[model samples]
Target: MGTTSDQTAQHEGSKAAMGGLIVCPVDLDRPGLRVLDSGTGDGYWLQDLLGTYPRLVDGTLVGTDVTAAKFPKHGAPQPISLQIQSITQPWPSEWKHSFDLVHQRLVLGACGSFPHATAVRNLAELVKPGGWIQLIEPDQTCGIQDGPAMRDFIKLVTWVFERMGGHARYAYDVKRWLLDAGVVDVEERSVPNYLGARVPDADLARRTARWTADAMMPLLKYTEGHDGPIPIPREDLQTLVPRLHEELLERGGFYPLRVIYGRVPLAKE
Candidate 1:
């Protein structure tokens, strides 16, 4: 449901919300640094990392997704490898423990069919000893404000996620998942995400609103066509997007997020 421009806007918004491209304090200039981005939609995260640190041009950067449909039509940015991969399945044997950093964001929807903890464990296996594993996820359970329509939207989305077998509010438990995976020095950073007038920047607010609306459209349509206990009825679902946007613009909203990271323990340190 997200266009390229919409994806770009959301990517920039996440960067602004998190305050930087790389958040784990890992050295980007290190020679031969190896990095992996799971569920790399359009390879945006990998592209931004290389663009931010030109010295990493020689470093090995790879982005993987379950499919290549969203990858750049021409090719991934120079020196970045895009592959077809599913985080729930076994990765290439050669890739085991090969990356200095493993990163993923907003992919809980993709992990809906399986336990997210298992996916996290799979991602952790790719990190080299002493390397970092970082995950950024949207928090749907708290900080939301204004708009009964928006509240219904959240409820419908949460129902969809739960029906698909993933918890919509799984971000709160990610630190324990990392700890169980044997990752050390775990850190969780919370960031305030404002939509509509809640954000000081008007342009960003509008773009974020559009992104939200676009994302909700497909889900709304799905619920309308499918048989489920959707919070919004089919007739109301038809007008929900416009109402949600109006509420966001008039009253503003907050959707907090989490940036969690930790280092895999070094071998026999």
Candidate 2:
């Protein structure tokens, strides 16, 4: 999942299916536009945006991650910068209420390490008044109609995330959190994503399934509580992955992806 090729493909695939990067519909040509992508893995999303909206090269684009090691080596156009920072922690004081757009995708793992409310508030704090904050995350609980193996896999995923203080239901609760943070004009949409080649976009579905299978390995191997050296055991994955992959290839097997966006209320004049 850390590979540049893999990240790039994921970014492109998601963009193709979910529409453009930011959902708030801001003019890309707007001057002094500041954008922040928290947990910006591989910086692919920001890079794509900069490439597509060349005018944004003059605006400030920042990508933050826990480490800069996996950041794309090729320098982006001017005004693009990368910082090593944890999204779960208190952000720089200067950054508070500074960004025109704050985006975070698939950050459940990192955000789960801390209080969900705190994390959501930290992300909201970065948006300027009337600016937008967007979040995209998968519902890890289960697919639309999972088979035995797929069900088991979902259970394992939930167990692991819960053990690590994360949640599979974070997507569902994000809207409420945004509302509490004084965000307005909140809107959310969910896309049911098929894991196998049974969908119209067969290749995309299959590739996504395979990518998900590949990503689940390390997660399954995670050790938890004093139960055993191996939490679920590696052998289980060896048997489960293939079966789950096959299950996904069939009809009625899909996961839900939630996209939530809201605007920070403008300050009273």
TM-score of each: 0.93, 0.86
lDDT of 2 by residue, 66-129 (tens): 8878775775446778888897777999999999999998885666568887788889999999
In angstroms, how far off is 209's CA in candidate 2?
Answer: 2.5
RMSD of 1: 2.0
RMSD of 2: 2.9
Report the CA-based lDDT of candidate 2 relative to the real structure: 0.75
Model 2 earns a TM-score of 0.86
Task: Give the runs in model 1 whose Cα sits over 4 Å from its true position.
Answer: 1-4, 142-144
Ten residues in sequence with the least summed lDDT for candidate 1 = 1-10
Report the C-alpha lDDT of model 1 over 130-171, residue by residue, as the tens digit.
Answer: 899899998885453557877877887788888788878899
After best superposition, candidate 1 residue 135: deviation in angstroms?
0.4
TM-score of structure candidate 1: 0.93
lDDT of 2 at 154: 72
Poorly placed runs, candidate 2 (over 4 Å): 1-4, 199-203, 224-234, 246-253
Best by lDDT: 1
